[model samples]
Target chain A: MDAMVEQGPEGSFVLGKVDDLLNLARKNSLWYMLFGTACCAIELMQTGGPRSDADRFGMVFRATPRQSDTLILAGTITYKMASRIRLLYEQMAEPKYVIAMGSCANTGGLFQESYAVVNGGDLFLPVDVYIPGCPPRSESLIEGLMLIQQKIEKEPWLKKAWTNTKNPKDPQIEGLL
Target chain B: MTSEALIDYVKGLLGDKTKWADPEAGDNFLTVASEDWKNICQTLATDKKCSLTYLRNFTGTDYPEDDEIELTAHTFSYSEKHGLIIKTRISREAAVCDTLSKIWPAAIWYEREIFDLLGVSFNNHPDLRRILMPEDWVGHPLRKDYKQQETYRGIPTTRPA
Candidate 1:
C-alpha cells in the first residue's frame, strides 16, 4: 500500500505503491522495438509516423530490445532467424509484452509455402496481443494497443504480476487461448 | 512505334513460332514454346526497334490436376511503347526453367518468388532461395495439393476457414 520495498519472485525490486499503480500504468509509456521484417513493417512505421502517431498512445519506438517494454514482431519470422528472435525475447526485462503485428507474424501470410519462414513469431515466443492484417492498417495496431492497455487496466492480475508467483504445480501454461 | 505497330512487328518475327493465346481481346496472351523463351526474351530486350526495356512481372501459375506449371514473362519496350505477355509451361515433374537473371536483373525477384511459392527451379538463378516463405518452411503453399498445416511450433495458428 505504501512505498514498501518488496523483493519479487524474480529477485527484482518491486515498489508496492498501490496508489501510484494507476499513475505508473499511465506514465510507463510503452516502448516498442519495431521488428519490421517485411511489408507489415512498413505499416507499423506508419503507426509511429505523422499519420497514426502511435506516439499518441504513449507508444514510443525503440531500436534496442533491452530498452523496450513491448516487442512488435511486425513481419515474417523465418526459421533461420527464429533462434535469434527467441534470444532477444529472453533478453527483455520482466513484465515485458509482445505484440504480434501482421499476417506473416500471425500465420505466415502468403509465404506459408517456403521452407525458410518460421510461419509466425508465436512459434518462438508467447505473444501477449495479436493485431491481425495482411498488415493490419496502422489504425488497427493503435486499436490493438488500446485493447491491450484496457485489458491490462481491468485485470488486477496485470498489476499484481510480480506478487502472483507462477505456480509450478501447473505443468502447462494458460493463455488467451 | 506505337503498341499496335510494335505488336504487329513482333507478330511477323515469330511467324509460326507463337500461338494467339487470347485473340478474343480484353487481355493479350501469347504462348511461346518453352525452349525458345530465352531467345525471345533476349530479342525483345535488344531488338533494334522493339527494345523492350521494362520487365513488368514474371510469375508462375500451378495446376495440380494437370501436373503442369505455367509462367508469364510480361515485357514492355518504352521506346516502341509496347507491352507483350510471353507465356510458357513446364511439367510439374520438371519444374525447371532457364534463368533470365542474366538478361533482366528484376527477373531475379520474380524467379525467387516462383521458387518460393511454386517450387519452380530456375536453372541458373544466382540466388535461387526462398524469398517469401521461411527458409526452412516445408512445403509450397500455392500448389493446389497443399497440405493441411497446424502450429509452427507450440503456438496455435489461425487456420484459414
Candidate 2:
C-alpha cells in the first residue's frame, strides 16, 4: 500500500511497492512509434496535435521502434508490408504494446476482398487494442490509449517473469515462427 | 496540330505498319503488329511532325475471348501540344512485347507495373521486376482469369467468408 507517513512544508515521502511505482511510471509515459501507412495516419497526427493533445496523458511519438513502448497501426496492412511490420515489431523493447487503429488494421475493412491487402493485422501481429472506424476519430484513439494504460496498471511484470508465464496473445507469434 | 491531324500524320508515316481503328466518339487510336511496335514507336518519337516525346501512360488489357493481350501507350508532345494512342496486340499464350524504354525512359516503371499486374513481359527492359507485388508473388493479380492464392508467405490473403 502507498501512503503518506508524515506531512512537511517541503515535501512528504510515500512508501509503495516497486511494481506499483513501475506500473505508474510506465502507464503515464507510453512513447508510441511514429508508424502509419494510410488515412488513419491523419487521425493519429491530429490526436498528437494541439486539438486532441495526446501529450496530456504522457503519450508521445517516437521516431524509432527501439525507443517506443507502444505501436499504433494506423492503416491498411499489405502482404508486401507485413514482413516489414514484423521487422519493426521485433526491433522494439520488451513489454511493448500494439494498438490496431482504424477498420483497415482491424479487419482490412473495405479492402478485405483485396488481392494484396492482408485481412487484418492480428493475423500476424499480437494486437493489444482495436479502434473501430473507417478511420477512428481522435477522441476514440485517446480512449484506446487509456485502455492500454489500464492494461499496463494491472500487469505484474516481475511476477510474470518469475512464474515463467507467457502472454495469451502470443499464438500468432508462435505460428509466425 | 490537333489529335486528328496528329493521328493522320502518324498514319502517313507508319503507312502499312499501322492499322487505324475507327475513332470512337473522341478517342482515336491505332493498332500495330507486335513485331513493328518498337520501330513504329521510334518513328513516332523521332519524326519531325509527330514528336511524341512524353509517354503519358502505358498499360495493358487482357482479352480472353480474343486469345490476345492489348498493350496501350498514350504519347504526348509538350512542344506540339498534341497526343496519340498507339496499341499492339500480342498472343496471350506468349505475352511478350518490345520495351519502349529506350525511346521514352518514363516507360521503365510503367512497363514494370504492367508486367507485375498483367503478366506482360517487356523484352530487353532494363529492370523488369515486380513494382507493386512481392518478388515471390505467384500469379498476375489483374489477369482476367487470375485466381487469388490461398496464402502469401503464410499470411492468409482472403478473409473468413
Candidate 3:
C-alpha cells in the first residue's frame, strides 16, 4: 500500500530526515480554492477545465479553503468584499501562497475607476505571482501556476504573511467604505 | 408593446425624473436620478410585461473634479425588452443610493462591489464588505484620485523611474 511505502525510511528520508516526504507532499498535490469573483474567474476556470488541464501541473480545484494549499484571487476585488477576502486568506492553512490572477486582481483592469473595485489583490494578501490581463488568456494562468510552483519549491518561507498578518502590531489599513 | 409605449408607461411612474439619453450602438439608454434608481429598477424587473429578469452587470465611474460618479446598470429584458442601459449620476460628496438588492438578489453583490470600489455608500445593502481587496486594504482602489500604495498583499509595488 502507498501508506506502507510512505512509512518506509527509504521512501521518505532524504539525508536522514523527512525532507523528501515534505517535498513529495508539496510536489504531488496542490489544491487551490475557487475564489474567482469576476471576468478573470472565467479564464481561471478555463485553466483547470478540460482544454487546459492544469492537473498535469499538479493543481486541482478545492471546494473549501481549509483543504487548499494555494489561493487564486482571480478577479476584481472590490472594497465591499475586501474584509471577507482577508478572512478567507486567514482561513487558509499554513504554507499557502496567493496568486493574483488577471488585471482586475493585479491592477483593477478597466474597472479601476469604478467605485467598487479593489485596485489590486496584493492590497489584501501577499501575491506570489501576478498574472496580468483584462482577463489574462488561459495560457497566462497556466504559466503563473507553474511559476508559483517553482517559487514554492524555492522559498517556502514566503508564507510568513499568513502568520505575520495576525500580529497585533500589523497595521490596520483603511478602505473605501 | 412598443418602445414608445413602454417609455411612456415608465414616464408615468418616474414622471419628470426620467430623461431618455439618445440611443447609441443599437441600445436605448435612460438617465435617471440616483435617488430614483431603486424604484425604477423594481418597475423594470418586476413588471410582468416588461420583465427585465437579468442584470447584465454594472460599473461606476468617478469624475472627481466634477464631483460626480456615474453608475451604469445594464439590464436584459426577456420580452419586448430591447436591452436597456440605465445610467444615473450622483454627486461624489454625498454619494448615497438606495440598494436595489431587494428586487434583484444579484444586485446585492454588484451594489456592494460599486460601494467597495467607488466609496459610495448603498443606504440599505444587507451585507457590505470588500470583494476583491484585503480587509485592511486602504482606500478605494478605483477612485481617480487614489494614491498608489507601496505595499499590497505583502508585495512591494514600485513606481516607474
Candidate 4:
C-alpha cells in the first residue's frame, strides 16, 4: 500500500509517514570509517568480528570518509593528528555522526599528562556518542553504536539539533572552542 | 673483540679528546667534548681497527639543572663484531652539533627527532624538521623545563580530570 503512493507533483501530500520511513532507513545503514590510531582499534575490530558482528545492525566499515556516515575514533588523538581528524570530518557527508570509542579518544586516558596527546576528540570534532573505557570492549562499543542509532531516529529534519553555524552552548564544548 | 678492548681502542683513538671514560660502567659508555666529537666519530667509522660502521641509535638527554644537553650515539661493527658509545656534552645556551647524517644516512631521522624533542640544532643536516611533533609546535616538550600549553589553535588541551 505504501508503494502505491503518488509519484506526481503532489507526492509530499500523498506520503504521510515519509519522515518515519526515512529515519528508519538512515538509522539502520550507518557506514563507519575504518580509521583507528591506537589500542582502541583492537576492540573496534573485535566488534566487527564473528561474535559481535556489527553487520547485524547494517553497519559496515568504509575506507574513505567521503563515503562514510560515521567516524569511530578508536584510539589516542595527539596534537599532530588533530588537524588530520578535522580534515577527515570535513570530508564526510552531511548528517554524519562521531563516536568517541575508548578513554583515549574520549579523554586521553593514561596519556592525559603527556605533552603530545590531545585531551579528547570532542575538543576538535562534534562527537555524537562517547564509549568510555581505557579500551572499551566490543560489547560496550556495540551498545554505544545502538545509542547513536536511537539519537538519529529521535532527531527532527526541519529543526535539526546539530548546526555548523555555532558552537554548542555546553561550557565544556565552549571552552574547547 | 670484548667490550673492554673495544672501549680501550676507542679511548686511544680519542686520545686528548676523551673528556671522561667509564670502562667498568654497566655499558661501555664514555663522554667527549663537543669540539672533538666529529673527528672521533669519523675515525671510528673509517678506520679498519675501530670500524663502528652501523649506527644503532642516536639521541639526546636534557639536563636543565646543569644547563647542559648530552647527545649520544651507539654504533656497532659487523666486521669487528663489537659496539661503541660516543657522547658529547654541550651547554644549553649553544646547543649545536656537527651533523652525522653524512656518515650514517639513518642519522637523518634520528638527528631531526633529537632536534624536535630536545632543541639541539644540527649543522649541515640535509633536511631537519620535526619528526614526532607538529611543525608549528612552540616549544620542545621533552625538555625538563617544558610546560604544557593550555590550548592549541583554540582547542583546549588540558585534561578534564
Name the best candidate (by lDDT): 2
**Candidate numbers, best DockQ first, in rank order:** 2, 4, 1, 3
Each predicted complex: what DockQ? 0.21, 0.52, 0.11, 0.37
Residue A38 of model 4, lDDT score: 95
lDDT of 1 by residue, B1-161 (tens): 76567668889987888787656657677788889988888887888887877899899999877888999988887766678888998999878889998889999999999998889998878999988665656788778787745555433344334
- Model 3 reaches what TM-score against the true structure? 0.53
Q: Which stretches of candidate 1 lie over 4 Å from their true place?
A: A1-29, A35-59, A73-87, A99-124, A127-177, B158-161
Quote the true-contact fraction of every model. Answer: 0.23, 0.62, 0.04, 0.58
Give the Å shift of residue B118 in candidate 2.
1.4
Summarize candidate 4's per-residue lDDT along A68-141 as a digit string, tens digits. 98999999999878878877877787788899998888888889888888888887887889999988899999
Off by over 4 Å in 2: A1-15, A162-177, B23-26
Q: After superposition, how far is residue B93 of candidate 1 from its true place, in Å?
A: 0.8
Q: Please state the error at residue A39 of candidate 2 in Å.
A: 1.5
Identify the runs in model 4 with alpha carbons over 4 angstroms from their true place. Answer: A1-16, A158-177, B23-25
Mind giving the per-residue lDDT tens digits that candidate 3 earns over A39-127? 88888888889999989878899888889888888887766566667778778887778888877787777776555566677665677
DockQ-derived CAPRI band for the predicted complex in model 2? medium
Q: Write the per-residue lDDT of candidate 4 for residues B1-161, one digit (tens) a residue.
A: 88878767766776766755555657757787788778778888998997888999999999988999999899999988998888999999788999998888999999999999999999999998998987778899778988877877667789654
Docking class of 4: acceptable
Predicted structure 2: lDDT: 0.88
- Candidates' C-alpha lDDT: 0.75, 0.88, 0.75, 0.83
Residue B38 lDDT (model 2): 97
Candidate 2 C-alpha lDDT tens digits along A1-177: 254567678887667677888899999999999999999999999999999999999999999999999999999989888888877887887888999999999999999988999888988888999999989999999999999999999888778653224456553332232
Off by over 4 Å in 3: A1-21, A156-177, B1-161
**Backbone clashes in model 2:** 0
Chain A of candidate 3 scores what in TM-score?
0.78
